[model samples]
Target chain A: MGGDFHWVATEPSGAGRDILPADAVLFGNGRQALYAVLMEGRRRFGWRVCHLPAYICQSVVQAARAADMECRYYRALPAADESPDWPPFQSRHEVLLSANVLGFSGLDLVPPDWPNENRIEDHTHDPWSRAACESRAGYCLVSLRKTLPTPDGGAAWSPLGLPCPSPEALIPGHAAAGQEKLAAMLLKRHYLSGMAVEKEEFRAWQIQSEAAMSIQPTSRPLPVTASMLPHLPWRRWRVERARNAEYLTDRLLGSLTAPALEPDRREVLPPPTPRRFPEQCPFAVVLLCRNRRERDRLREALIQRRVYPPIFWPLPEEAARRHPEAADFAARMLALPCDFRYTPEDLEEAAEVIREFFQTEAG
Target chain B: MGGDFHWVATEPSGAGRDILPADAVLFGNGRQALYAVLMEGRRRFGWRVCHLPAYICQSVVQAARAADMECRYYRALPAADESPDWPPFQSRHEVLLSANVLGFSGLDLVPPDWPNENRIEDHTHDPWSRAACESRAGYCLVSLRKTLPTPDGGAAWSPLGLPCPSPEALIPGHAAAGQEKLAAMLLKRHYLSGMAVEKEEFRAWQIQSEAAMSIQPTSRPLPVTASMLPHLPWRRWRVERARNAEYLTDRLLGSLTAPALEPDRREVLPPPTPRRFPEQCPFAVVLLCRNRRERDRLREALIQRRVYPPIFWPLPEEAARRHPEAADFAARMLALPCDFRYTPEDLEEAAEVIREFFQTEAG
Candidate 1:
């Protein structure tokens, strides 16, 4: 939860969409937000949910385990050719959870007139997207921590108008140590390079928190996390992120003689029309490589330069069998970073580095 | 690890002795140096080992578990006396690791001829003692970290001339991280209230070290840590420890009408021993309270004044079935601080507190 991050806010899309009733559900930390939603379908509705995006952390799988649900990967369609071929869901599944890939392409992927028993949308990747706001789903979960510089926070809203349980029931000791951990994280960030030292301190805090959890009498209901969430530097963060991504994309297109884009088959989300502000959360420039090796090589090169971009969804094999298209996309796709941390100049340098590697390989 | 209190060192005992082969074994970080000897046992005698201790922190348990061994614990023993009856070991247990009641009484409760493939002695408490210096059927492990400011170090020696594995087999990652942790602990001691911060950092480092061990490639055999290890502030650490224990003991006896020493059960080792160091590691000054509640109340009082002491070892009923004598000792035992951190003045004040509690209770 400790990171230098930003968030973008938009006017709430009011309630009154397609609705479905839900029973008890569980929530997870930021990284597993999507998986938590997907697993909930399997848990409550006995839906053998499968075919999720491949690229994600182990925590996502763990969330499923926590809920006693099984997960399988889905294939991602290539960005250039977005002909969506999703795996068939079992008729018995009353719920489906879908994600907008990196905020770039959502509509091209989702099936029109999708069955909506307990459709849940995840807003972790693109919180400011109108897709979530306009979705005709029963519920949606948002990972506030991913977008903001807060230690931990999340929200789940139900279109069915089901009220949330009291905050005490959700996370009993949430407030007891959240503030202290936040403070410790802040202190640790001050000495970032002193990772060894910082990690030690952070771990101690974690142990204490764990101990507190163990000793807590029983699970108490929590209405919601009520502390004031930090306001994000939306405008500046968005502008810089877009500018960087665009600059890098342009340079890569000019220098690399690879399959640049298949405009006929691909559909990029139109520039976000900022609702509350002139700018919004920047979307990544996702590239679908011709093969997996090229993507891996490019990823390695970028890491060597200390520029890590989010790559392939970790679609498990079982999920891939369900969503072959998603599996294919995951194998060839790579995401380039376009965040507030980089500037135009940094993008130019990154582009040149990529160009040199590909040109040398071709020669 | 974080506490608001400080311990002061007592005057050094001028007498010198060869504190080698320790008396018993402890499992955790502050375990006596004799563990090195046991690790050698693993190498020399491919014995499938099982360590008996509380299922506590990961680092301590990991050391044994990492070796592909298992650790078992005696269930919580209720207090009936100063010590619980020693529990019967599973037939498979080759070694029994025991400790001096937090620097109070040695493992004199266990009969001299307890059945075990070997008896590993841990001498964190009074590391200078020679009573159990000879390894009856097993080696002794001694931890130097508890007594000295060393970052990481321990030794295990045997009187039976058992061959040990090379020290090279000791996982390097753990040793290195342990050194760093030791340095941090030393630095953190200078500050109050931030002990938790430092301890947390140490725990993380410990975890990383353990993880590193999991992936390390199998290598050449490690050498056995020997008894003839070079001196490292042994005289100074032991002298200060004994002086502190004696200082507090004198004050408690003078202030309280009841005798501090249980004359009927006393088993004092002769002074001026040649094999062990003249000074002892003053880990704690254990006291025999009348009952569990009294000990708990006394501990609470000490904690209120920021004078923290080691926790009392509870003797469960199962333990009583095995070593009935231990049950009696477990109930009335409390260990006071006697580490090098405590000064004469601190000891005096601590003794006064203990005396006041008992005096008021007697009235």
Candidate 2:
């Protein structure tokens, strides 16, 4: 809870609504929402194969596998500013999946030429982004647990008002997982507020709750999460996160090329913009390093300054083998926290840590 | 939370300390404890087969199967008052499991002739009974979660002070399950105290937490349970339960043979004594009916009068087929809960309901 921004239980203030669709079907976690959507798609539209981003979380691949659907990978590297490079469409019984990576871009990952009815868009990073709000994809999915201060919640909805599947009645394991996660959040809140609760206590809850949720992929969301949805201040959180990400991006721009671990052997690559659109509530202000060694060094330096940045993912072995560029992008990238939990001062300190690391390495 | 007794979280008052052994190994639930003991036995003594009671919970069989040990059935019928009849023991590589069923008898279920080194005894119903306290078996296991107000806890120890395997570590799933169950108990406490909490909320937590615990068959107990074990009022609870059970048994003694469902075809079978030893804290005051039909009729009548009696078990298909008498015993038995939750007036009301049912059936 202290090392990274773990969610905490919050009072339901009823400050916002419409963060998700009124009819959004909720599940235990993001992967379950995705799995449910895939299975429903297979049932209603005869979707057989799903094309997924090469740069993705392993759980997504697992969800697809659990749905008994064949998966094909497409290029969706972090450096790509626009839509993923489209693979040839098999007009029958095939679906394409796209994600707004780290909310760095608008929800326009689905290529224009692709059939709109066969596309599934994941708006987990920034569900409030304008593009996501006006998404024309067949279905949209969001991982509410990641963004909201709730124990367990993943939502799926058809933006076009197509028939969607509702989750079966809540299962006991999933319910327990939600409760466990909720307890962790509550305990973390106590620890954060200078209470006697230990950090290990909350961490244990977070880890165990995830293990429980992983095995229960298609169960209904917890009752607490469902009740808390309308009360969450989603809009305010999004705005604050956007401001933090923008500030960090501007602060880090000048020293982007300063840390060249192998100056003589390689040409300096221009760092990509932190966000493709100004309107996005970016998940984080991402940095591109010269290599994995440099990224790891910067990560340690940030940690020393009490700035905990997360690696987007370690590419799954199959994806890494199939798409080396995606793997390389994953290796070179690190994400600085720009969530609502941070303030301007926190970002300033984090920015200073990044600059100091590069300056020290350059020396 | 309201219909049947579920655990309720209580403040640790340090009123009891010797309920469990000082070095007892803790687990997520009773079945997990059993599984851990079987696996440990296999590792230490090369034990490959386990003889389990025919009238037993399915989870116990599943646990033995999970440990890759062959299971053989024995006649440990509910009607048997003293020790189970001896089955040929393969002293070289076989283990025998016995239980103090509903705490009706002492920890003397293991035949006098059987080797103490090859016996495992379950004291789930009455861990504090005199016989359990003085057990001489190689191993003893108890389902602490069922008897205690803690979320999740099972314990394993050797009465002979022999080698025991400890849980590896607290896994995330087991930890979460404990938290969920704890939440349920807390909610139930509020409900019992006439709080506005919905009964379903706590009930859902109870159901889900159990599912979470079921899959984790060999994990450490929750930190809360570990800390609370030393403080639980175990002795007081046992004594209170014993008093309630004794009172109910006396009240029902006169009407025992009145419910002759088919008066002409069979001689009335005398009801077995609720407890073989008067000093025992019975898990429940069990009533043996004439047949399954009478048992079902009596169960419904009791429920209508707000007295919920649980069936010990419905025999697993294999067991039912292998031992028809055990199946018959299971079908004809209804356990009237005499746990510490009920007051004297509550027991009086339940006793009235039970007597009323039999009188109407006799008419």
Candidate 3:
């Protein structure tokens, strides 16, 4: 072993020094960042209730609750076969949260005429969605921790040109979360440097850190994370993921089914939209199963080959029980790992795993 | 200065080492810790809606909201004369939150038989409350930042034997917050060592750090905070506050009103209970005003003298509009700082200031 590998900032961009407008700010998590905007709106404009898509995560719901805003859902997913409808506008309705559900999928953007001040674009799942960057709303929220190797951070900026909240300082537990991540990086480096690494201990720390993050009180990003996030080669990552997603999409074209029990396979491929954001980041290569059974079977088949997929959400029981469509959506929506971590070969291997599952199951 | 003030841990005891049971956990703030318990209850026990005291802070409401718990208020304060009534319970109701309002004064313990599993005791205002340590209910939350010099910490325990989640890792923002606090401590030490301290810059950092804390996401106590908190002379501080509360109580026994515009001053003070948990800690020396006019006048008077008091809570519009009783409660409650930082002479000065204000107003 030559020497210890340095692991401090992930992106080397020194993002903290990036000359951004007062409109941009960093928060502990995407939810906190979005919640800040909602809080600001409620505090300044007396906004009480908000409109959100029924197809959403609990974090989004909790963020609004944190801001003490009453939520009423409007259909926004492509699965809901109806013209996108906005919830009936009321004076009490202060904001409309238009979420980019999956980076490459989900409903089209809400009309520009929809109240801008009342809009907070939730770009948690898809930072590459059109509204993800140039938020036409009062706030744009992006959860980048999952996208990047950094421990905890989310960014929010006002598209309406409102000043953003100042970045908050880190408390202890938050720094520890980031520290654990840094430690993991160090361990990997030590092994690469031909030093003995306690892989099991590193894994234990990884699990512990993940558990800690789940319940840790939301706060601003670590100073290290702030600098790292911006330095990321975002354009390259976005392009790569887009290409990977496209490859997977084309392979599975005519083979995927809408989340339904009757197995209504989508035979015709939807015309691919031109990527407006040069840095089009794809969170996952999402695929729909014909039913819950098919989804489970395909998931099991993939895992056996060391192929892991992310269940975007388990669809909290409450959400499922209240909205049956959400349950159906949760049961059928499967996300393939097409993150920057994967290569073209890896994508092909993952696609082949799926093809094998469907062929065997059908036969 | 003779030497640099070695500033790191807040409590000299090296607190983080304290062995705690699985039932208890420390968090970044009391509200966040309490919120975790609420989340657990809602997730595990199907607690959808809860009844809280209308006379409460936004933090409590927000905590419950953060857990997606619908709240219904039952009169817990002294406004209604009869024994406190619990809101009508339904199967969906998972828990009822009982709060210890002011550090020194508020409601008595909820009836012992009041479904222990369904109760979460908020000991934020009074950690010395009987429920503070051996939580007889599902959860007992205490906000301790105001009690000690530690930058931030709160604790909650499940005496009902509920399993507590593992502690989380710290992110950068929290560590930064702690660092800022450590810097302030160093400055204070420098000044104490007979040095010409830059008080303005110190105040700027203080203000900046405070703002940092406000926006920082809630998480478990930083490694430093957790360690510093346990090392604190908790027992001594607790006794001092109790002594202070009694002294203030004796001086103005009949002066406090029942937090109303139309005064409901209790002519007879409740009998003081013997401190079983000898380490009795009080968040503040609370004083009720005869009316909103009187409360504001006293607050202004104290501020002019550089003696700041906490305004317990500024009732949220939603809370105030729905619960008028809470708004009235907010208008009249005033809290005087009686933490360990203040001496007996300091208490005497504060009392005199209050006495002078009322006397001058009447004159």
Candidate 4:
């Protein structure tokens, strides 16, 4: 076996002494984890209706669908106080999904009157949030791939310490997935190094490998992935990500109106403010464009400089019909990478590129 | 990029020109396929109650549980005519799992009056049975790995041309599972080729790899696995298996009890005749001991000689309660491999080994 052949994945554990007990299971992806709790809840409590935010990953909907539950949604927007603004809904027996987008928000958004046992936090983008992991909701869920180098890992655990099936039972499925990802990781390393190779073909192959994992909805995380969980420099990475997000926000403050930087409280008209996700070890530095055209233009400019910023989603037709705000967010939002891999200088260069794009537009 | 590195999986296609229409989707295992159809049926038709044979793989129950449906099983006994004797209960909206075990039985057992639209055939063990592929059930599902060397693959298709999602979408999950399998395959090859490896250590690692695949359910067959689909010598395997079964049955007629060679219409107390399963590619050659004690003794004897014939299962408590016959089968039934890989002489050696043990016991 070569040194760079198979990658070490994130170990399945809590920050300190809290090993995600046997009751808290880790799976191949976030959706699978979400599916697990929904299925468990449905089987024991006859919960057939699943309630989640309109502004969430498509996988969340897919998870509910897989669990054979009726999906209903309510608003999940950042309020003026920068807390999650969960809209009121009449859900008696529905399983509610309380999600934290970009890691910082939504944990505080549960409607106080709803049964706490019904809420499952979709902390897919907020794996390291102390509040997310420590929450007293019936279940706390997180996806590791978004914040870590693991090929695939999603976790769901009982906050109440209920007895749950051990994820070890799902390992056969993880091993299957691990085979393809290991090859891709090796191929990626080879490509990233000075070795000459066909880049696009390799990339397409890697994408194909990744696509295969999504279809395996109920598998467990690989042992190699589970091994590195405790070793991750969580606090440092979290701090660096927060620092990077703050830095980018301060630089892009007046130049590009970021709603996340500080919510506008009122308008849906002019360019939306950059919504700042404070205190969270974010998946990316998110920015909102005035319109799709402006977003596309900035995206193109960034691409030319070899800086790739991904859009939140393309928006499914059903989702678009259900939440127009989500559709708008999909059209105009851009996510800049700020994971543990980047340095302050690298982020500075990326921010400068964004500044140049607007300055050129004004000229 | 070693030549013997990764085994190319079968290129997915329906048998012959049918290529399993676009409506047919493949997955990582048979349970995943079962889970898929169950979830789809529950979501689309308000099908919440699931009915399946008590005599089945543990994964079938696991899959049903994962789908969050109410599972109610019925007793299934091999009919006097060698077909499945399915007990009748009034079911209007319930989804029925019509399954084929040992690739020879059950398909013929479907009640003529039962709604075909409500039936989903678990043909994981019966891929080569022509009648099974031609069944009129709403969905026909199979796991390719049981019949093929591909590390992980499961397929579910609508024989009725129901609209289904493209399996290509699940490739990422498959790729993730593939990497672990490829590594294990490499290790297996190395171990087999006189590499002087630690046998148990390698086996544990391989087991870990397989465990990962079970976790990553709902994934597509790998492209490599799909590529080899057409090339698999299905006919040859079926013929070799049939011939081997007949030969063993002819030789061991009064000396042993084989449920799948040529069924004895009358006595279970007498020396058992071979029950025929001609024209089907079987997972193994079935043998039943007179009692659990004899089974244990024979199993140990076979192990001492390195001719390992595996017990069907060590029955689960719930399964044992629901289907005592299945539990009995599990305790006494043993399956001997008769795959394409075995040569005539190799099979003869295995058959002779069993013959010698029984002859000594009788003496």
Worst 10 residues of 1 chain A by lDDT: A221-230
Model 2 agreement with the true structure over A318-359: per-residue lDDT tens digits: 779989888888888888777788888888888788778777
What DockQ would candidate 1 receive versus the native complex?
A: 0.02
Task: Please give the TM-score that candidate 4 achieves against the real structure.
Answer: 0.49
- TM-scores of chain B alone in all candidate structures, in the order given: 0.60, 0.90, 0.80, 0.83
For each candidate, how many residue pairs have backbone atoms clashing (under 3 Å)? 95, 2, 34, 89
Per-prediction DockQ: 0.02, 0.10, 0.01, 0.08
Is candidate 2 or 3 superior in TM-score? Answer: 2
CAPRI band of model 2? incorrect
lDDT of 1 by residue, A1-363 (tens): 112332112122222112112332323233334444444456555666544444443444455455454555444443544544455655666445566556554554355555555466666656555565556665566555444444445555565543432223434354333333433333344234222233444445444532342212222211111112212444455566666656666676655445543333222222223321222233566655567787788778877886666655766676667656666667766667667666677777777777776676666
Please tell me which model should have the higher DockQ, number 1 or number 4. Answer: 4
Worst 10 residues of 3 chain A by lDDT: A1-10
Summing lDDT over every window of 10 consecutive residues in candidate 2 chain B, give the lowest-scoring window. B263-272
TM-score of each: 0.47, 0.58, 0.46, 0.49
True contacts kept of 2: 0.17
By TM-score, is 1 or 3 better? 1
Q: How many clashes show up in model 1?
A: 95
Pick by TM-score: which candidate is best?
A: 2
In candidate 4, what fraction of native interface contacts survive? Answer: 0.19
The positional error of residue B227 in candidate 3, measured at the CA in angstroms, is: 29
